[model samples]
Target: MGIKSALSKPFASFVVKKINKWKYHAVEAQQKVFKTLISSAQDTAFGKDHHFSTIKNYEDFKKQVPVVDYEGLRKYIDRVVEGEENVLWKGKPLYFAKTSGTTSGVKYIPISKESMPEHIKAARNALLTYIHETGRADFVDGKMIFLQGSPEMDKKGGIYFGRLSGIVAHHVPGYLQKNRLPGYDTNCIEDWETKVDAIVEETIHEDMRLISGIPPWCQMYFDRLSAKAGGKKIKDIFQNFNLFVYGGVNYEPYRAKIEETIGRRVDSIETYPASEGFIAYQDSQTEKGLLLLADAGIFYEFIPTEEYFNESPTRLSLGEIELDKNYAIVLNTSAGLWGYSIGDTVKFISKNPYKILVTGRIKHYISAFGEHVIGEEVEYALLTVAKEEGLEVTEFTVAPQVNPEEGELPYHEWFVEFVKAPADMEEFRLKVDQQLQKKNIYYSDLIEGKVLQPLKISMLQPHAFINMMKAEGKLGGQNKVPRLTNDRDLADKLQKYLL
Candidate 1:
């Protein structure tokens, strides 16, 4: 074994043990983080404005500071961009993670010096947790590749600003520097197509082991690798490539096709990360959920998904959250975001040693006909039936088809790209429709009442979604196709790609 591999096993054990202690004391850990954040930022300008010094509890916090999105905090963020000190957090932010939002356009989320390490630590622990549980530290010796944005940045008010993935690229640990592939110049390529080509060239002949990225982009990389080898599977190209690490989107929808490309299934890790914080990671190889990072420099509050927009939604702390119920997650972080709604929804799967599964995004859903179908439901429905049909799906999105040409009822249109299609297209559509009905009773009711017809599947050409993302200038680096849309905007644009 290499020096790094030989050394990581013991370090993994130590980190795992420390994580275990914090996991079990999760509620207490979160409470402590809450107190520390409130105490430390109490003297900042925002703290003074919100009476943070006098706030003693969650109740006081709820009453004093209202929930806000990026636009809601625009004034304070403007000050930060102008190099104002102590405007929100204790001092000037270390960096700004620039991201494009659906409704808010570009956003610059502050990452404090204190909060930056938490992002690094959480990502490191995900791998360490895998090593500790499965005793698989051998891959540490092989070249590792994380497909991410360019490390290039533009400074705003003396703060380095770029995509979150790009910003984190600057901090990859020194030990792994020798093992990480697709060098700085390759990563700095602007066009994603050119960049991914460079990534393939750099790592195609290396002893690559772990490949990490959002699923769709990983799929793109795999496609290039497969083509370069004249149809040889990815496993044949990189025998040591046994682990896939993904976040930002559910992997299940693309799993069948991705594994098909690999010619075998590999162990994978799921993570919950955002511009706001690194929230959780898959901690157990045997378990089903990502362990919540209660000690990760962020305090979490959850509002029931059904009541999220209520004038006073019930906000539950870590100790008060229940199992299997969807909630819109809110963050109060040391990065200067307070009572912030990150727009993602999640469901707790385990309590004491808290663990969660991301259910869907709060805004990304199809409720045009009062049949509110979420990203999770559609994914579950399609994948479940696709498994039965022995088919492989590439990517898909659902949007309401509100107006038919004439004398036709509106329906949910699923634009799907497939690697292997089932024999009977109509039958496959029926099964998927039935599965979705089973998962969502409201959708079932709509079908039965004739308010809407059954869902229709629009088969898309290969690379349809990729082409669409390219046209929208969101081809890579944490950008993903929205799984569900209430409007026809994306659906209409996607129609040209349908077969």
Candidate 2:
């Protein structure tokens, strides 16, 4: 056995034992988390307003606190931003994770000192769980390249602000730091392209064994690395590379391209992490979905996606969740976010282990012609069509073509950037349309009733999506092409760069 594997064996066994126990004790674990959260913040302003002192159990807590989105918590957050103490949590937040906003400027999510450890622990446990399950602890023996946001934070009103990845980069453990790349100076570079160049120069010949990042940016890194190494496959340059830890966006569409770039198969582990919290991770290799982090300092609630927009919606706890139902996730975290809606939709695929698949975003869907098509449906259709046609798609986005000039009926418009275009583009488009209709009955009915036109396909030139993101100043980590939009805004913008 390798030295890394030998050293990690005992810890890996411990992690495996803990995870095995967690599955059976998920309910008790979550209940304890909820109780601790309530007690921790009972003296805060939000807790008082929500009658936290009077709440005794889950039912009482639910009855007292209403489900709210970011906007609903804006007032409290604004106060916290002005350096108010104990406004949301027990004390001031150590930093604020700045994320893309909803139709506004930006969102500042509070990260408390008490909650930071939970975030760090969950992330560490994800890798540990993967190692335990896969028995591949030697992954830690070599360099693990993390393609992330700049570590350099900006201070505003006495609060540090930066991407969650950037913030986490600052806290990487000392032992792991010794095996990580690119260097600190390279990570601190502000521009995406320039930073990528620096990373290539710094780690071109290092003993890289693992890579973790958003799918699109990782693809960019692979392509650049290949180009720099005289067009050789990535595995040729980093022979020890054996694992890919990916998250932040769907990986299905990019899988073929990534595999082709690497020139060989590698074990992949997916995570469901957001700025609010590290929620889930791939625990078992045999499992098809992520194991919900019930024990991880975050209490989860599921609201039926359709009912989420209703005047009143039913919120179901982890025990009440049913398999295969789409739910808009609401979280009450140790970070002092009480009953807050994070806006992402997910569906439970397994119950015993409590595994879930992220379905879509709450605000991200196409409902323009009475046809409610979601991100999951679109992605499934696109991926299915690509696989059937032996095509490779780099990126894609969909929006409704509501204004079709004169008298034409409205249709779903797809802007796709293909690394390998299909031999029969028309056939590929028809298959995608058919697959989408199969996935969504409402879309099929609209097409059958002649209420909507056939799906329109527009192929984008190489680098178009990247250029669009760059122009909008969101070209790197965690920023992805909004898959399905309700309006023509994204489609119209991409049309300017159509091939």
Candidate 3:
């Protein structure tokens, strides 16, 4: 409980051994999972209209089951609401996990009992690995807090769709279920404020150690808790909390301020979870990237990064996957999605297929100046520069901005909100510019031409980024305001508040 002695070198090596062992088995285990998937998918009740039958071999499955995005599932999603029991699964879905849709609006994604266990197992595995890394699993006496979205169920008592947090909430061990936030699995998401407040009020006394949620919401809770505590820092309310588990988007943007506010270097865990599956987790104490859930109840597929924009991408099976290659991740889930590209790209960090670094979202890239900068790329570059320059940046947003001079290339405009003022922004901007170029060759070329001018620093009032998101109806409940936007919509809306 006393920080576990900083995870020594020998202990770190032991943890690495466990990781390698798990990964080695993961490759072989995935084949068995694939075999089971292939067999079950062939059943008329399981496949046919649901698209699982399309998978024969891994290659055949890739060809038959075309990459499906959020838009592709719209029609079938309506079928789910109509109570078509097997539309998105083998049997009746236990609940519908609501996730935000781009054009279709809020969508209720059906969660099958078969896939639910996978979520639970992956989550537990993540926790176990963290414990292994820190050698502190034995000391976890405090309650594990999960800040999830609404858990409203429908006419048949199935969960209404919203966010992954709510969907995964049901998977929390039944033994610990009673100890969670008030009405955690049954309350309306609209009442999140009330529920969260009640949870804070109740748990303020308990030794709540591990807290997990999206950064903004957790920050909101911390802010409110701090205010309620009459300017007491975050440490007072959750006095025992040391580990912060966050997902949904990049954590680097808010890392510095969050640590400062909490008054400690908190152990932060990153997760790559989609409605399709709990894809990966950062198992190592070093916290570089996530280890993919290769043996989860999903058959994985990957398309080379070069093929991402192709009309018909040539897919690669798990067997063919190579390390250090960027691939757009696709999933063939037990819940009936086949060859579904979840729109995220990952680069293998090790030869082990199970470990990867989430590079970026497939569609969430900006290439206006021929610099193919994705969300993760920009995030890494910005974080690296900030760390090097010792700048205390809390939040930032980047968009493609065009300079109106004839024949000039469009450039990136960075909207940075720093917590502490940097003494020399000129040197900091130069460092950032260097990092940007180093990250991607095209971005560097653009910078050299003055196409993308110096990085812009915009000082914002306290909690400015979050407040603006709330004002735009893009905050609260399940909505996560994006840290990086490809277009200028968010930037345009937020320009008035910029310094």
Q: Pick the candidate with the highest lDDT.
A: 1
Q: How many clashing residue pairs appear in each of the predictions shown? A: 0, 0, 3
By TM-score, the better pick of 1 and 2 is 1
Q: Per-model C-alpha lDDT, please?
A: 0.91, 0.88, 0.70
How big is the positional error of residue 260 in model 3, measured in Å on the Cα after superposition? 1.0
Candidate 1 ranges beyond 4 A from true positions: none
- Compared with the true structure, what per-residue lDDT tens digits does model 3 show for residues 28-55? 7677878887666565343675455555
Query: By summed lDDT, which 10 consecutive residues of candidate 1 come out lowest?
Result: 98-107
Determine which window of 10 residues in candidate 2 has minimal summed lDDT. 1-10
**lDDT, residue 100, candidate 3:** 63
Which regions of candidate 3 are displaced past 4 Å?
1-22, 44-46, 49-55, 156-162, 182-196, 403-409, 449-451
lDDT preference between candidates 2 and 3, better one: 2
